[model samples]
Target: MRTYWDLCVGFARTGVTGYGGGPSTIPLIEYEAVKKYKWMTEEEFGESLALANTLPGPIATKMAAYVGYKIKGPLGAFVAIMAHIVPSLIGMLGLLGVLYTFKSSAVVKGMINGVAPVVGVMLAVMAYQFFQKGRQGLGSKWMIGMSLFSLCVIEFLNLHPGFVIILFLTSAFVWSTYKESGKTLFTRKQVMRSREEEL
Candidate 1:
């Protein structure tokens, strides 16, 4: 059984230092869960990430809850979720205090302006990591296609993210079932191959 301290430390570290946004924080969470703790294999982490993306709420919190629940059920989930959120909660409060006191500080203006470059870097890294992880799980060429398709739909069509995710999740289920049943619903050549195998 994993101890509370172990869970707290691992997730707290992620929460405390995961600057920028949830996408940027994911790599940090992956490092602790998949690398430092051995809580999940890389493949499992990838799968978990996919599943978490489908769920409602912030991806980081959902991920922490899933990992913790896997390790120790409901109680583990509670601890992990709290650990993941506590740092952000404290940081927000601190920032609010700073903003209140430094409403007119030039230092604050400089800090905000400087953060854009760093955030851009973080987001770039996050996007690249997502590409690599998706490619590993879903082939290099196909990953690019899917990424482009998702980007276009999200940006051009302006569809809600939840709707898009649900659409893909349903598509994946149907595709997987077809593959498992040896049914070639989408290709005439594969249908013929399955028939030939039967003979």
Candidate 2:
């Protein structure tokens, strides 16, 4: 029950407060999932974010569902998603007409413009943290090389991000497998050499 309530409140806070939609809400969601609730470590959350990006649909919803299900199963996922979206739904129902009418007002425009910078800073901070983590895990050279490669494919070649993530994941899996097999073969050769020396 406490878990359910926590899930509700956590996602609800993000729903009510998150401005500029899915991408912008990420930092707030990270706070609840990682810092507030301690549901996942930062590294786990980073991996989850990578996986979530590879899927379709709204990033916020996917993350809410994932965290919810991870903590409390399918019902928790239902609760989390509801809490995450209901506030936005109600606001949309109530404020859509008003916002549309005042969309061109200078005050409204300025308010949005101001918020945009805050959101940009939030995303930049998150990206830098992830960059640091990647550097620690992959080493600076590999991280920078992969970053450049990913940038080229994503920004210049116009390849989809989901495809790029999948490509990297596949490459990592293959490389890991090769390394394990090489170690196994090396151990076998060492064993054979010892046996020959004994003979």
Candidate 3:
């Protein structure tokens, strides 16, 4: 019960503070679940993120459910998901009322304009963090090349991200399989020789 309450509170706070909707909430959710709570390892969190990205529903809610399930099973999942959603539900309702009332207010317009730049900066920071973390083994050259290639493919070619992901994964799978087969065929002789020597 205590665990459920704590999880609920944690996710509720995440929902309340998370700005700019689901995509924007990702970093905050990662921070709370992976860094603050130690509910999941970084690798586990990454896997959950990838899975959530592939699914249709709200990313933050999916993440919250996964982490909660990891901690306390189905009941925890219920608590965490409800916690994460409730704040957004309430806030959106209130925001809708305000927006309806102040639809033409200059102050609201100014506030929106002010927030846009801040949101841009936040997204930029998040992008930089993702790039730094993702480019660890590849080095800057490969990282930059991949980034440029992706941008060209997505922006210029107007390729769907799902297709790009499929193409990359298919290529990687073929290459990995080929490499493994070659290694297997060549390494058996060496292994046999080592075994004979041991005998």
Model number with the top TM-score: 2
Ranking by TM-score: 2, 3, 1
Better of 1 and 3 by TM-score: 3
Query: In candidate 1, what residue range of length 10 has the lowest lDDT sum?
Result: 180-189
User: Which candidate should be chosen as best, given lDDT against the real structure?
Assistant: 2
Against the true structure, what is each candidate's TM-score?
0.79, 0.92, 0.83
- TM-score of model number 1: 0.79
Which runs of model 3 end up more than 4 angstroms from their true locations? 195-199
| Candidate 2 CA-lDDT value | 0.94
Question: What are the root-mean-square deviations of the candidates from the true structure over C-alphas?
Answer: 4.4, 1.6, 2.6
Q: What tens-digit string does per-residue lDDT give for candidate 2 at 1-199?
A: 9999999999999999899889889999999999999999998999999889988899999999999999999999999999999988999999999999999999999999989999999999998998899999899999999999999999999998888889998999999999999999999999999999999
Model 2 residue 14 CA deviation in Å? 1.2
Prediction 2 TM-score vs. true: 0.92
